[model samples]
Target: MKSEPEYTPFELMAVAGARELKDGEIVAVGLGLPVVATFLAKRTHAPHITILFELGVVDPEPIHTGVGLADPRVWYRAKILSSFVDMLGMVLHRGLVDVGFLGGLETDAYGNLNTTLLGDPKGKFRHFVGSGGANDIASSARRTIIIIRHEARKLNEAVSFVTSPGYLRGYGERASAGLQGGPSRVITDKAVFGFDPESKRMRLESIHPGNTVEDVLANLSFQPIVPDAVSTTEPPTAEQVRLIREEIDPERVYAG
Candidate 1:
């Protein structure tokens, strides 16, 4: 009998994130692991997925995960190279986006994100790379997918600031505030969390292999709605691992 292949947490995270995307969906992809996952989906399952960058890059077949969002290498072979206004105002706000793929410094039970600062906003707070169109994407995209590290401090009861609105306090609050889309899932190295449809609280959908429910719970500042039984995340297949190692992110730019 053959045993399962070895895989890194980053590879597992990327494959797990990629599986959430569907073919032909227009996805607003942010920098970091999300870029890797989105491209992996396009290469394997979601070939027709339309990738959108905040800087107005649409359907760009990136040669590699670039040094930064502005790196020229990330814009190679684009279907449409446009402006921020066109992508955010014209496309996103128009309610045409299917999925918003993003990463942040922190996330809360409500799925609210913070890429801004750690300490109290009114006090001495260190700055972080602020929401560069993440706010727009999460606000208008039909659904948003967040990928971030799983740590107690990073998974707070509430984020320092609401850089991107999730359920925004509860179930009807987002709609009350006129925000179109809400967070769909939060994928971490240890687990995958989904929001409760009624209460809008985060719930443990699955735990990554090698991690237990207690392990996942211990990393979160707030308790999530865990079910009686949790599924294990599907690990990356041999082909997917090969693609990630050789094609998608050979340099370990983002997936690592």
Candidate 2:
């Protein structure tokens, strides 16, 4: 146990993020950590995986984060350079995307995300940013995966605002209203969470090493139900972390 590995915050979360992609799956990585995980996967495991960026770049042979789809780096060896609308509406909305990876400013216990307005009615943001294509991706993605560095406030009961929708109330109630593409898996700094099939609420499945249920629950927005017997989240092997932090991002990206 002592000689196993020691992972940094991002590295740990990145590992959890990477596992969300299977051996072969098309993942629509939002950017940043999600991108890091995808790149890591391309290098270490999912050689045949297709990573599509919101900016319309596909299968970019990037060693680090590009500024955006239009960034020269993205176009250098990319397979596609289409438009955002076409990608989301025509491609993504049609369920062509296998996974949609998202990073968030806040995530509710049910995995509801708030990435746009923070907390204000008049314009006060607890944590704000341009939403980009989050809305479409949330509603039409084949499946959604959320990547966030876990903390108490960020994973609170009430987000200052509603950004990307998640298990707001429940499934049937939501489906009847026509809201689609809810959270599939939520990877965080502390643990990996998934929706309970029955309750349809985000439930703790595993704990990260050096972290505990108490640690995670202590900061959650609402009380998260622990599976009768919870277990520790499997951490990345030293090799996986090194591949992402070093081999994959050899250039030390300024913006990923």
Candidate 3:
């Protein structure tokens, strides 16, 4: 059977995250982009990369299917199936996971994340679905990576709720909260961004293909500073583009 083509943007984001994985690393991946990246890494160079699903499965070889942890395939491919109690204990207390790949409802210049709620405090969106194990994922992983669609609405000046707990109050303060690793890189539709050492703010590192640095900056809600000589986001090589298009989401892929 032949696999369908990939839409450009999702492929880009998946490749962006997939390229970061190292063999033998275990990533606590969120849904969607996380799923694509993990599977892509598995098929390519990092077959040893272990992916820990929040639902408590590990290193599921998804074959050619696009389904995730919920897919029946996961049960067959997974090494273990356990309770949230055991998984939480392992994730938060045992110190086992290496990296966390999380998605955000929105992110701010400070890198604080909001994924569970939308509206606000007091009466707006009164009760919330709330954050998932993301709190633990952020607290335990050695490093964190965030994937989000780029836009003014999704990238705000300040987060509505610090649900996922970026550098609470500030960077070192996360250590005080017992959070091991806060967001290290935030990849988006238009560019790649990271936290500045001194200011603890996000700065533009690279722009995506077909988009100019000015275009990325213009779409952001607040000012995003560029380095003296900003670099372009590396395009996915022919290898990455092929796997993402073929095996990841063969039916149809999403674009930015």
Candidate 4:
């Protein structure tokens, strides 16, 4: 029998995130793993997936792994080279984008994200890159997917500050605020979580290979609703692994 291919946690995370996207859907992609995931999706299963960068490149075929959205590599072969205002206001704010991918320093049960600071705003604290267009994309996209590292400190009962709205107070609160959609799924190294339809709280949907419910629970600060029939995340196929290693990110910039 052929043995399973070795893959890193980042590769697993990217593949898992890529699977959430569908063909013919327009996705507002951010930097880091979200960029890698969307590229992998376009190269493989969702060939028709449209990728839009916050800096205003639409359907760009990046020549190589990019440092950020504005990198020249990301601007290669772009279908639309427009201004930031046009992209965010005309495209995103109009609700044309199907999904938005985001990352943050902290997230809560309601999926509220804090990419701002670690402690009280008035006190000395570790500061992170503030929201550029993350807040706008998260609020206006039809659905949003958050990708973050899984750790007890990063997963909180409530983020220190709500940089981007998720379900707000949960359930009807998001709709009440007139937001079209809220966080739909969260992809992590250990597991996959989805929001409970009624409660709007994050729930354990599936665990990644080599991880268990106990492992996931141990890393999370708060108790996430667990379904009885949690499934294992689909492992990356040999072909997918090959594409990621050789074609997608040979330098191991984001795929590592």
Candidate 5:
């Protein structure tokens, strides 16, 4: 028998994100890690999952994993290459999507995301590719999963700007804004987080393998609520590792 290949941190993160998805759910997938995780989920467990790209590709089983959301390879064997307005406006806004998978530059305890600007939006600072369709997905999807790197700077007490609403000011604020759903989970290299019931603040649900709760705490700019019995995140199984390496990302494009 062939020995199982070692996985990287990114691979671990991807697997973690993939495990959150359930069978038959329609997922609005953005670029970067979200793409890899959604694809892996479909191939492994959620075979009936409908994946929608921001660029209007729906349920495409690409010949190969392309570089980003806009790549031509993503459209392979697509069920429908619909127009942008039809995908986002009709499908997403009409509450047809089950989950939105997104990535960002920074996130807060409230799960608010900031992907548009760095530092103060008022002053001189760097600007990223503005919310292509992340804002729409986050606002309209039934729930969302955020995948991002864990660090002090990335996990802040408050994001510089709310590119995508989470709980907003907390406890019904999101709902008051006419948004249907909000962020349900955040998967990082160090841990997995879910929102508290009453407070709507992020709670450390589990620490990743080889990482401690203290390590996760140290990296966050704000104090995340910790459960009394925090568990360790399940490590990727050999099958998951194999599929990610050999089938999902043979070229190591994103999973690497």
Candidate 6:
């Protein structure tokens, strides 16, 4: 019997991210791995997925991954190229977005993401680009999907600042604050997490192949609810590996 194709963690991550999106869903995608994942989905199972770039490029059939969100390469064959207002105000805030893809420097148990700072916000701290369109996307998109590296520092008990609201404190908190959508899934290189319906606390959904639940817990500072039986993340098919390497991200811009 022919053995299954070997795949890297990043390839597995891309496939995992692609699986979260459903066909015909409208996604507001961020940069890097999120872009690669979205493109992979569009090329494969979710061909009709509508992609919206924060900079106002809509449904772009990018020939290759762009250097940045503004790069012209990402806008190739775009159905609409407009301004931030059109994309964020007209489309996103209007509740047209089905899913929002995001990445961050830190995320807490409640799914609150912090892309703004590293240290104390009130005192000395390392500052990062606070939020481009992440806030709007997180708030209004029907549901949000976070893609980030699995590291102890990135997963915290509480982020330094709440750049993008998840559940705020917990369940019903978002509704009380008049927030719309909340975080649904978080995809990492080692595992997949989903929030509990009652407490809104993060819980382990699956562990990637070759990684155990212990491997995942060792990297997290806070405890995530682990079920008695956790599913293994399905590895990317040989075709998915080929599509990622040959068609989607040939230059290794994002997937690499």
Runs in model 5 lying further than 4 Å from the true structure: 1-5
Q: RMSD to the native, candidate 4?
A: 1.2
- What lDDT does candidate 6 reach at residue 49? 97
Clashing pairs in 6: none
Which is the winner by lDDT between candidate 4 and candidate 6? 6
Query: Poorest 10 consecutive residues of model 3 by lDDT?
Result: 247-256
Question: Could you give me the TM-score of model 5 versus the true structure?
Answer: 0.95
Give a tens-digit lDDT track for model 2, residues 163-248.
77777766565476587667888888788889887567888888888887888887676887787798887888989867866766
Off by over 4 Å in 3: 1-7, 63-73, 126-129, 169-171, 253-256
> Residue 160 of model 3: what lDDT?
79
Query: For residues 109-220, could you state the per-residue lDDT of candidate 1 as single tens digits?
Result: 9999998888989998999888899999988999999998999988988899999999978879989998777999999999999999999999999999999999999889
**Which regions in candidate 6 have their CA more than 4 angstroms from the true location?**
none
Better of 4 and 6 by TM-score: 6
Q: Which residue pairs collide in model 1, if any?
A: none
Which tens-of-lDDT digit does each residue in 123-223 have in candidate 4?
87888888999999989999999999999999998898889999987889988988879898999899999999999999999999999899999999999
**Can you tell me which runs of candidate 1 are displaced by over 4 Å?**
none
lDDT of 6: 0.91
Question: After superposition on all CA atoms, what RMSD does each candidate show versus the true structure?
Answer: 1.0, 2.5, 3.8, 1.2, 1.8, 1.0
Model 3 superposed RMSD (Cα): 3.8
Best-to-worst ranking by lDDT: 6, 1, 4, 5, 2, 3
Better of 1 and 5 by TM-score: 1
Could you tell me the TM-score of candidate 2? 0.90
Candidate with the greatest lDDT versus the true structure: 6
Once model 4 is optimally superposed onto the true structure by TM-score, how far is the C-alpha of residue 245 displaced, in angstroms? 1.3
| Best of the two (3, 6) by TM-score | 6
RMSD of 5: 1.8
What is candidate 5's lDDT per residue for 26-105, written digit by digit as tens? 99988777878998899888999999987788888776867676778878888998777988988998889999998899
Q: What is the per-residue lDDT of model 6 for residues 1-256, given as tens digits with 9 covering 90 to 100?
A: 9688988788888899999999999999988888888988999999999999988899887776678887899899999999899998899999999999999998999899999999977899999989999999999999999988999999988888999999998889998999977999999989999999999999999999889988999999899889899999988999999999998889987777
Count of clashing residue pairs in every prediction:
0, 4, 0, 0, 0, 0
Output the better candidate (2/3) by TM-score: 2
